[model samples]
Target: MATWAIGDIQGCFDEFTALLRAIDFRPDRDRLWLVGDLVNRGPKSLETLRFVHSLGDGAITLLGNHDLHLLAVAAGHGRLRRGDTLDEVLGAPDREPLLDWLRGRPLFHYDPALDMAMVHAALAPGWDLATAKTRAAEVQTALTSDADGYFAHMYGDTPHRWDNALRGWRRLRVITDYLTRVRFCRPDGTYDMRAKGPPGTQPEGYLPWFALPDRASAGTPIVFGHWSSIGLVDGHDVYALDTGCVWGRQLSALCLEEGRWVSVDCSARGSGAGD
Candidate 1:
């Protein structure tokens, strides 16, 4: 069975399905690794969530920032942003189950045999695979056990760097950020949360998280999304597949075993970018 890794769908169900078709995805025989942002910003959030939920074991989906925001809003911890299209999901009959499944999803996934790891965004420069897994479990535990408290303190850009001594909400928030919202960061691993543009446009002292010198997770290949502006990156043992389908670009997928890409145009379904 082939394993295919796909970029953020962001509720663009038509483009998602089209890309699936383009890849000749066979749910019965193939497994899918989705880089999250499964819902929000497009026209059919409910449909997109339902379809992915229906896939069950056929797919492994990480929780993106949008996915967490949906849960936070549903739990009354977050306010809806101007471009959010998550109302349908919030109002759906199956919203509870859908959100529950999403909350339980891990922030990181690893395949020891392939030595490949996946996260919605980037790993902290200091975190090797072992540290990533442990830290991810910490947040997962908090999310599952005290979602109210977890979402309550989830928003922020402080503690811009990871510290082994961090604890409580501070620790959880930093881990969540690294696994979900990270982009440009300093060589010392301090995140430049404000820099969202492409690589060359990063702030003076920052570089893409993956480009950080001597990153502990450097050797192992990482499949990630969340930086659509940079589009598809297929080298340096990093696979960035978020091709901005929601922004009138292509929805991309990479065959893990073969390292080949299959994409579908999404201009007709484009609805601009939304966080």
Candidate 2:
């Protein structure tokens, strides 16, 4: 059986299907690991959600910022953004099941036997695999238990760093930021959420999280997708898969065990940058 890890779909269902076809994906025998952002910004958010959800055990998706935003909006905690294409999803007849299923997805996915892990964004510089998993579970619990309350407090850059002493929403907020929206960060695990460009454009004091010299997760193989600006990078023990498919770029995927890569060109331009 083959295991393929795909980049953000972001409602670009046509390109997503094309990429799957290019990989010759056999749902009965192959497994797909999606690096989140399965909806929004493209034309078919509703179809995208249903297609992935229909995949059942054949697929696994981690939650990205867009996925969380969908939940927040569904819970009446977030406002529709200028470029959001989530109306189809919100108005769908199956919206409840789709949103609930999305909320249940983990913020991080790791398999020790395969020596692989996946997160929508960066793993905190200070977190090892075990600690990252535990922290993810903590946030997941809060998200599942009180989705509205969680969504209400989810929007922020506060407590911009991770601290063991952090408790309540502060701790969950920081963890959510790291696992979903992080790109550049200080070595101390403090985030630079405002920097949306590629590595060279980041502030002088910060570095791409994966580039940190002392990152505890450095040696662990990770698959992440939030940095579409960085495109399809493969290095630093991580595979960067978000190829800006929703922005007229290519949809990409990596064969985990073989380290092979495949992609399909996309023509849809749904949203602008800094999503």
Candidate 3:
């Protein structure tokens, strides 16, 4: 039974299927792990969601920012923005089961047998393997519980240092941002929601989350998406799998068991089109 960790799908259903075919993925035998962003921005969000939901126990998915945005909009927390393309899902006939399955998903997932912890974004510095699992569980538990209030509060870009005393919706928002939208943080742990390009463009005193000192899950591989502009980066310990699927470049997948990368070119599509 092979286990493959695929990059952000972001609604690019065609590429997803092509990649699976290329890998000879058999749902009945092989397990598939996803870095998340299974829907949104691409042309076939509905198909993507359906395929993922059917994977059942053979699938491991860590939630991505777009995935949450879908839930938020479905729950009436956010409006559809320009360039958004998720209507097919929010208006689908089977939307209830899909959304429920998504809500039940977690922000972090690790199989100790695989020795890998998966997330949507980078882990904060100074957290060890245990801490990664613990903190991820903390936020995910809240999201899975009575989290309507949590969704209402999961916006903004302030109150940066992760203090345990952080209470109410504000705390939930911070944790959500960390697990979902973060790329870089200030030296003191302030999030940079504005920085979106590759590394090195951040202001002084701000550094990418992976660059922080004594990071959590130091040697354990963390498969993640959510930074297409960041592309595929190899930091020796983390896998940046958001290979600009929505940007007309390519969708990527890594065989974690062997640390192999396979990319399906989306350049055949329009220059600025992908998921």
Candidate 4:
């Protein structure tokens, strides 16, 4: 059996299917690992969600920011912003099932056999693998327990840094941001959530999370997305699989077992866009 790590789908269902076909993905014999953002910002959000959900055990998906946003909006905790394209999903007949499946998904996934982990975005510099897992579970418990209350407080860019001493919603917010929205971050562990460009565009003191000198999770291969602007970067023991497929780029997939990559040009477009 083959294990393939695919980049963000972001509602680009056509390209997603094309990439799967290109890789000869057989649900019976192959397992797929998705980096998340399975819906939003591209055509066919509902279709993308349904197809992935139908894959059942053949697919393992970590929740991305968009996925959380969908849940938030569905729970009446967040609003649909300008350029948002999630109406179809919100109004779908299967919305509850889809949303339920998504909320049940974790913020992080690890395979002990592969010594590999997957998150929607970057891990904080201070979190070793064990710490990362424990912290992820904390946020997951909060998210699944009181989703309405969780989504109500899920937004924001502060406290800007992580502290184990942080409590309540503030702690969960920090963990969610780091795991879902982070890109450029300072060595001191403060996030630059506004920086969305490539590596050189980071603010003066900030660098890509993985590039930090003291990143504690550097020991494991963390496959992640949420940085479409950076496209595909595969070094420093991390795999960035988002190839901007929703922006008319390519859908990417990496064969983790063989370290092989496969991509297919995307043709979908929609009003919404971002990392």
Candidate 5:
């Protein structure tokens, strides 16, 4: 069996199909690991969601910020903003099954056999691999529960930092934001919602999550998207594959087994930087 971990799709279904064909993916024997943002911003939000849903057990997807936004909007915690392209998913006749399946999907995925973990965004600093796996599950449980009261508190900043003692909906919100929306965090682990660029441009007080001291997963290959500005930083066992395909640049795919990286030119990727 072969496993390939690809970067953020962001609704560029055509680019994704090209990548899969280029890799000659064998559905029966190959497993695909997607780093999330499977929908929104591109022209094929519905198609992207449906395609990944069709993959079923053959694919492993870690929830990205956009994915979480879709879930929150579905559950009534978030409101759609301009440029959001998830209307089809929210109104589909199969909405129930689709949202149910999506809400239950893992936010952070790790395969010990491959010595790799894939997340939509970077892991919080100070967390080892085990810490990430454990904490990720905690929020996943809350989000997947019928008592999704957690969604009500999903827009806050108090629980922005990890606290083992955090309980209930607030805890779930913090966990969700970190796992899904986090980019740069202050040295004390507080997230800087205002900063949204490469580590070099980040405010002086913040650091990239992976660059923090004592980062246990520094040796384990961690695949993530959400940072097209950082592009493809090949260091400390971390890879950033969101080359802003939805912004009309190029879509990227990093083949885990072959160590082969491919980028396909795109005309409709995300152009909203400093966004």
Candidate 6:
């Protein structure tokens, strides 16, 4: 069986399917590691969610910021913003089951045999694999057990650094940000939440999270998306698969075993700004 890691879908169902076809994906024999953003900002949020949900065990999807936003909005904690195309999903008959499945999805996934880890965004400089797993579980527990409470305090950019002493919703929010919203940060693990441009555009004193010196997770190969501006990076023992598909670029996929890429052009489908 083959394992393919795909970049963000972001509700671009047609492009997603096209990429799947280009990769010759067979649900019965291949597994998909989706780097989240499964819905939002594209033309078919509802269809995208339904299709991924139908994949069941054939796919392992992390929860991206968009997915979390969907959950938050569904739970009445977040409001739909301009350019959001999630109305169909919110109005769908299966919205509850879809949101439930999404909420239950983990923030991190690791495959020991492959010696690879996946997250929707970047890992904090301080978190090694074991620590990442533990921290992820903390948010997962809060999301499942106290979603109301978690979502209530989920949106923020404070506590810009990781602290072992952090407590309550602040702790959960930072953890979630590292896994889902981070891009640039300092070697000290302080996030520059405002820098969203490609490399060389980060604010002074900041480096891309993966480029931070002596990152604890540096030894293990990581697969991640969420930074579409710096598309398709294969170095630093990490694979960045977000090729800006939602922005009129290519939808990319990497074969885990072969380390080869298969992409589908998405110029026709791309629209809206990427987060």
Clashes of 3: 4
Model 4 Cα lDDT, one tens digit per residue, 139-204? 889877888889999998889899989999999999999999999888889998989888998889
TM-score of each: 0.97, 0.98, 0.93, 0.97, 0.94, 0.98
- Candidate 6, clashing residue pairs? none
lDDT of 2 by residue, 106-210 (tens): 998897768999999998898999999999999999987877788999998898999999999888999999999999998898898999888899988899999
TM-score of 5: 0.94
Q: Answer with 3 or 6, whichever has the higher TM-score.
A: 6
Give the poorly placed runs of model 2, Cα more than 4 Å off: 268-272
The collision pairs in model 4 are: none
Local distance difference test values of all predictions, in order: 0.90, 0.91, 0.80, 0.90, 0.80, 0.92
RMSD of 4: 1.4
Top lDDT model: 6
Answer with 4 or 6, whichever has the higher lDDT: 6
Candidate 1: global Cα-lDDT?
A: 0.90
The collision pairs in model 5 are: 245-269, 246-269, 246-270, 247-269, 247-270, 248-269
Clash number by candidate, in order: 0, 0, 4, 0, 6, 0
Q: Give the range where candidate 4 is weakest over 10 consecutive residues by summed lDDT.
A: 266-275
Task: For candidate 6, write residues 24-44 as lDDT tens digits.
Answer: 999999999999999888798
How do the residues 190-231 of candidate 3 rate in per-residue lDDT, one tens digit apiece?
Answer: 777778777787777878787776665578877788877777
What C-alpha lDDT does candidate 4 achieve relative to the native structure?
Answer: 0.90
Q: Write the per-residue lDDT of candidate 5 for residues 146-233, one digit (tens) a residue.
A: 4357667777667668777888777777777777778888756788766777778888878888787776668898988887777787
